[model samples]
Target: MPTEILMPALSPTMEEGTLAKWLVKEGDEVNSGDLLAEIETDKATMEFEAVDEGTIGKILVAEGSEAVKVNTPIALLLEEGESADVMDNDAEGTQTTSDPDPQPKEQDGSGDGKASPVTESDTPAPAAPRDDKGERIFASPLARRIAAEKGLDLAQITGSGPHGRIVKADVVDAKAADAPAPAAAPEPSADKAPAAAPAGPSADAVAAMYQGRDYEEMKLDGMRKTIAARLTEAKQTVPHFYLRRDIRLDALMKFRSQLNKQLEERGVKLSVNDFIIKACALALQSVPDANAVWAGDRILKLKPSDVAVAVAIEGGLFTPVLRDADMKSLSALSTEMKDLAGRARDRKLSPEEYQGGTFAISNLGMFGIENFDAVINPPHGAILAVGAGVKKPVVGTDGELTMATVMSVTLSVDHRVIDGALGAQLLEQIVQNLENPMVMLA
Candidate 1:
């Protein structure tokens, strides 16, 4: 029997991907763990690997195909003794043996997991499942139907299948739990029931308004679409508050120059952003209560300072995370940030490189922007938006006016995770670290 090689869900959030390129063609003999294809997900391009040794019997999906759903059969594999002819009847009926779901492999340094390639098996899993909030849940169709028939909630079942997907065997003999009584629907009233949100104008309606005008209509790519959807959800669901602060950067600037001169021999140059990252990392430690993310039901306080920095690319942006940033030297942080940003621009970063962080930094100082509030990336307690450093007059401690280099920053905090006072403390600590640059080294 010919086995169907289904498209894999590389990242936990990936529902579909573009088959960017195929490394193996039909009739090629491949071993387990061999590179099979390049898949372009919403975040980055990743290489898919083979899980079992077999001869490629047929290619079902071609390279450069867009929006290919996960778990769809993309190729066929034949055992040593079998030939391509074995797929003739199977291909006609769209029936073939499929690989069991693959277990998630721990990504290096990235606490998040990535699913491995599937292996030859008897049953096929359905497309990835989703809950009401649109998060992906893995399960087979048979298991779903059985659970529905038994009046059991699939989310409660412990999946024994690969990647922890619920399967028929896991749910067949399970007893249904008691369902909670439904709540009464609230009546719409002027004083009690809230009004529904107004819907946005449709494409046709907007197009009609510009019927006589000439304009270019650009199509949205996967990256752009994901950004739009995620940010929209963030603004709508997350309770956000802002905290603004201004810091004197003259001391930091002088200290940076002195350090750069010594580090010049090692071919290392530190940017102001590097110092900002270190400042935020230390601030998270100083105000440990602010180092947290909002889970659905509770807050997850993280022990390490993992900071994500935004890097703009051709069509979208990537926030590559610097893990354990609080412990790294300034020079090391600079080097790692450069490498991550470079790879991020090239779209070569793995999912783990850009996934988890309790805090993020979005710096537009180089572009000469002066203080702007950034949207809070969900699950992160706060994001710091940095503006340019410019010379400004200020009163010195001795009541004398003097000119100093000042930089403006706004910390967008998630109120659900950090209160206003806690956010202020975090920002104050960051300001203290930046104003007294020598203290950071201590």
Candidate 2:
């Protein structure tokens, strides 16, 4: 029997991705766990693996194809001794185009009416846990695992997945609905209307406005489109509030100078941003109430400080997180941040390296920006925008004027998660940690 090789979802939010490269070709004999292709998601390029051993019968989707939706058949695999006649008939009956419509596969002469893994039915009949004979249940591997963990019986649940395959979501919904008290923890539901901004004018219509004007049209890539969509949603849905503060950085500068000299032999030169990362991490711990993220319906307060630092790249930017930053020394943070930033610029980072941070830091200080507000990334409670440190006249303890290095910072808080008072307290702790560098060491 021939099996359909569908496009695998590389990330949780991945709907479509680019088929960057195909490592296998038609008639190539492949075994389970073999690498078949390289899938380029929005964040990273990940290798796609084969789950069942078979011979590559055909390459349905070509390499370099972009926006290939998840679960779209990319190729076909045939078991040993299976004839190409089985595949030729299948391909002839199906349409092959940029938007291929999923069609069912021919039955393999098995008396059972259950469809094979290669066959896809868009509007499949609901899957029963057991057949008429009361044999073992037919379910997806992920579905079985989730059902076991949730203590739910697969035989009692109906599947809505492709070809009536029991999927992870089916089991999760069943378990949640069957729980003792459903209202206590309501399952997250999708909004009836998408939160996306209304569609803009057609490309031709927009071009008409600039006709006779000098302008070069630049097409947007995957990275640019993703950035646009995400930022738009953040501004429209997330209620954001700004908290401003100014901290004297004279002490941090002097301390950083001394530390850099000691770490010079180890090739670890610390930067002001490194100290900022450490300060933010410790502040999260000092004010644990602020160490939280908006988890759809609930707030998740984390014990470890995973701090994401924004690094600008060619297309857009990447926010690679440093896990447990509060527990690491200044030199360690400097070394780790440099490595992450280098890989990020080269587009070599994996999804895990750049995802899931409770908070983030974006410093345009090195660019000489005085002060600016940063948009809060979704699911994150807040983002710290740090500005350049400049010398300014200040009143001393004895009421005398003196010059000190002052850095302006703006904390962008998600009003849904952090209140105005709580945001102020969090900013105060960050400033206190930066003003007294020795306390961070302690």
Candidate 3:
């Protein structure tokens, strides 16, 4: 007996998907748990897997075809000597009787038995060449699906993304394949001449011709809807202010270098961000008001110092909650943070991983960013942005001025929840804790 490979439901928000690329070819040996295809859903490109092992016999759905429903028979796997006859008998809204020999129709042709448009293009225009080597592409799933359904070639599109990667809006507004450029309409004829073909069709007629496609509106997945609601509420409701301070980090850098060298045998590689997280946690203890949330008609102060650290993911971003940060060791926080971030990018995080916090941190320093203000993670009075530490000059005691490593930290605060004094006091603690790692250990 042969096994069928169904189109997978890649994400909770995904009702339909486009076959981005097939990992296995027809007649290829497939193993259970092997990645089968890359599926483009509404949110992101996800890998679909095979659960049953066998020889892959056919590719039922072509790549770049859109709106393929979940569980649709997408491919088939066969035992030795098994035929691809099962699909042949049931294809194109037809079925055969038990005794009838099924004939398989070749699916190599387009609607009119013509070659596919993908292969027909000899060369793209100079200004619109497609990315043959799509190394840094970033198209949204919805856009890819829409492009596929309409046969709009993505390669021919000049991507408007930062690095020229094709994005969703580019596909939606793409003109039809081989569509003539919109020409200026000829003027209507005078009494001496015949009336010209109604100039540019009336506006209503043009609009009707280009009406949007019919689509079934689906409910947002738990993750997407939650992201939207939270970000919107945070931006609209929170009264945010920022305070920036630069720390001379010559000691901290030397300290980290020495600590890592000594602990190299101990297997703990402490990142600067890890030190910052620990510092913030300890700082929250001394100025507890900074580690609190603002609720309707009351302020809910928290203990134990729960911190939400922002993690950027494929679809928007989420924060992983590091519970009782003030109580955890630097190594423990480092380990947990790595686990939470790994699971977050893989979309395997539970609600608890993202929810609840007294303070938050977003670090773009490793990416070489010098300064940025972060949006407050809700319920948390402040979110901290950590920048790259650089070499600078600082005045030291004993009337000595010297070059030192320095880092800039920015705190975005919700004014209603935390006053300027409390915010400043907490910042001082954070600075001190980072400067002296031994203090954070206590």
Q: Pick the candidate with the highest TM-score.
A: 2
- Give the TM-scores of the predictions, in the order they appear: 0.79, 0.80, 0.52
For candidate 3, lDDT tens digit of each residue in 148-190? 5666666567766433545455776887676422222223123
**On residues 50-80, what C-alpha lDDT tens digit does candidate 2 reach at each position?**
6556789889889999977666667877767
Candidate 2 error regions (>4 Å): 103-200
Full-model lDDT for every candidate: 0.78, 0.77, 0.67
TM-score order of candidates, best first? 2, 1, 3
Judged by whole-model lDDT over C-alpha atoms, candidate 3 comes out at 0.67
- In candidate 1 the C-alpha lDDT for residue 440 amounts to 82
Tens digits of lDDT, candidate 1, 1-442: 5655767877756666788999999999987568999999888898887655678988878889887666656787776787767556443444322322332221111112234443353233323344545444555445654665676666567877555766666778988867531222122123321112224897789899999999999887778878887787788889989999999999999999999999999999999999999999999999999999999899999999999999999999999999999999999999999999999988999989999999999999999999999998888989999999989999999999999999999999999999999999999999999999888898
Candidate 3 clash pair list: 130-155
Q: Model 1, 310: alpha-carbon shift in Å?
A: 0.7
